[model samples]
Target: MSSSLASLALVQQKTGAAQLDRFGDPTIVGVALAYFAVIVGVSVWAARRTRTASDFFVAGHGIGLVALTVASVSTSVSGFAFIGGPGLLYSVGLGALFLILPAAVTNVLGAWVLAKRMRLLGEVRGLMTVPDAIGARYRSPMAQGLSGIAILVGIVGYMATNCLAMGYVLDAIFGVGVTWGIWIGMGVTLAYSVAGGILAGIYNDVFQGTLMAVASSAVFVYVLKLGGGMAGLSNAITPTDAGFLGPFGKMTPLAALSLFFVFGMGSLGQPQAVHKYYMLRDPKQLKWYPMLKTVGQLVVLLLYFGVGVGVKALVSAQRMAPLAKPDAATPSFLLQFTPALLAGIVFAGVAAATMGATNSFINIGAAVVTHDLPTALGRPLRNELRWGRISTLVLALLAGLIAQYSGALVAFLGVFGWGLFASTTVPALAIGLNWAGATRAGAIASIVTGLATTLTLETLAYLKLYAFPAGVSGTAVGLVLSLLVFFAGSWLTRARAAAAIDGDVRLVMDV
Candidate 1:
């Protein structure tokens, strides 16, 4: 019996080794090269149009509704949806769905709360960055500067997450070591971002978003076949791990609900998606954004749900071994189960998500460094265009280092960044724009509170020094505290609201 067990172990080891050997197929390598060449072509085309700081930052406010919608979807989805998302689903079971469940309504909420006002404000007052909108709303450079600081922090964390994902996908596709994959991935993304700016990012997003939609939909069909549909998936997983299909899966109820709440409300504060509203040529098109974005997100998110359950079901049925790590779910499924060509497309889709998001963050980080921070400090640069490009390089380098050293999983890093942005920006930027009674003091207070609480709690948790009880997230705590402070501070400074908000800002909000 002992010898039989040894033989089984040997077989499993060989299976794992065989799976590793499948990484760099010629078909996949060819597809990846072809896709990248197309991306370079798009970047070159966009570079010609990106002559000014305004063009670099916001595509010169000339993007059409469809392009803007797709770009927004691509940025919002990112590597988290394609790679980290499935990993989370594999790790947490049903609980992972909480992270994206709010997509159904968040886009509509964003449209009603911020999109029209943001675009109108940009057109009226020439607003360029997310903090610029905050500064205009509250009439405070200090508020803008603090907001910029928080955005910069979140951007680095978020960029590192995407860069890490790019490392994984590139490694799987090219058979490069993860370290080389990271460096190569950053180089490719940085080249286009530095050359074409947001214009390149936007058009590339249009292409990438389309590819993701097609690949995700097609791959989901394969997932269904492998999992034998919902019934087979349940039969396989339930007998071995019944809890995985429960409402909250392995997570405590509180944790699942917290995820839902944070991700739901947090969408309002994500600059990568919200900032694109400024690029829409016509504010009248804002009415369609919610529906269009919701449909697009739902369609593209198929791979997020499909790959995870498919991998889990296969493992439960003893068809595949348990994954070495949750993040391996997507790549493993692609390589082991799908056709080589389909795997290549999905692999490219992963790169598309990571590179697109990295581009957005670098652009925002650049604007923060070159335009927002300097202006808030009353030292605005004369050549923001040149400085913005340089700042992108610097920010990319810093984030790449973080990606290299951080031991956290891609999904967790993405969550931290999301939480940071939600806590810091939601009350100050999203709420402040819609509420007439929000004072500059309140905005500053919320930003300070959010930034302080999130950074402190996340840092402590990361160091293993402390953790919240099950179901309680540090992000939720920070966001709740920030909201409380925002209201309290505004109440205390209620008389200053009229003085804080400009007449034009009031008109735009009212409209």
Candidate 2:
């Protein structure tokens, strides 16, 4: 069976290069247009439901568990799972295991530590954004404002990352210039996001997530069928490259594990992931959240592993040439193996979802700028929704432009955004929400410490001034420092005797 499978895979690889030549197939273009029409329809429906600020921010806190689960999982998948993940695996083999570890674990950990506490706070405080929860938790305008600033910084970087990815995707599929592709992505996303805000993100996520799940599954099946089977593929690669099958692949063990700390522990600080917590309609439904989230994440991630291994196997067997660039691995796979119709739908859907994800980042950043900052300063805007829409458009446009001119700046910001969020919010928001002794001073200090550490380290590394140790990522360092500062600051501030959490909040926490 293995011998036959290997032969079959070799035959497929020989033919795969010919498949890549179908650059602008009409079938693919047609599918993309049809899928886009569906997205526009969903955007209109969501826009109708999004007349109020609360509706724009949290879908009026009416999103059901199933929808929230799929959407949350979908949002987390982002560009990394579909586009970058396979490339990552191709370059470093089992180095992606560190990422996969957190991918599986964070959901359960988040459900236990964050889901209930955040959801409860949202219900009790009528929270609209993550910074709103931070403000209410710490009862400090300074902490709220500082967190808002941190969110804004992260948003620029996060949005830039998405824009760059979209640019590449559009360039490949439509043969357009990368800059034009980014502008196109920004225009489409801004239309619905400005119209519907989080409602657009939520409904679009559900729609996009369902499409991604189906397409990802079909692609995975194709990968397996083309490769014959995973075991056969493994055997083919094992002889020539033993390390490729090892647990750490080519990465230093320390570097591999650094991905874990950054992604696993740092995930709590991710405003985007935790953003969905506020929209769950029922608190008890959270009991099922981790399972649904994990299952959905794993299902979508099959493409990440399948294509990486399948392509590696084919290359080792001399049936395929080695990839020209790691980033091209995914596009190469789709062009070669998947049916033209399916490839069109999957690629277009993934690109649309990328825009939708960017919409979310812009929406949250706008909320922080317009609603949370003013509210913290005790001067709430009467026209918050209007200003927020304006901010979202501006932020998206700014990010798209920045992505085109300053790829390095985007990389610097994007690299630390996760850690910055994790370090700043994890202790102050995630842990603090559960720990009553968590003082406002501590939250404030931690946010400052995290922001400072991440910016300094990432910038220095980018400048080639004393690189981070091979296994040590800037994110892990920042996160550790932030936690330490939070504890030390809290201990000192506890001397003043902080106010107890509100009776209502306490009551909800106990529930």
Q: Which residue segments of model 2 deviate by more than 4 Å? A: 1-20, 408-415, 496-500
Question: How many clashes (backbone N, Cα, C below 3 Å) per candidate?
Answer: 1, 1
Error of 1 at 69 (Å): 1.1
TM-score of each: 0.98, 0.92
For candidate 1, write residues 45-116 as lDDT tens digits: 999988999999999999999998888888888888888999998888989999999997899999999999
Error of 2 at 337 (Å): 2.7
> Per-residue lDDT tens digits of candidate 2, residues 1-511?
6986777666657655455465677888788778778879988998888888898888888989988988887677766666667777877887776776787688988999888888888888888888888877777778888988887887787788778767766765776766887898788889899998998888888888888888888888887788778788888889978798898887788878887888899888888889888888898889898888989888888877887887788778766667766656767777766788888977886776677778789889999989988987889899888998999988998888888887453223445667778878899888887777788889999999998988888778767786676757887888899999999989888854246466776665566
- After superposing candidate 1 on the true structure, give the runs of residues whose Cα lies further than 4 Å from its correct spot: 1-11
Model 1: lDDT to the true structure: 0.90
In the order shown, the candidates' Cα RMSDs to the true structure are 1.4, 4.1
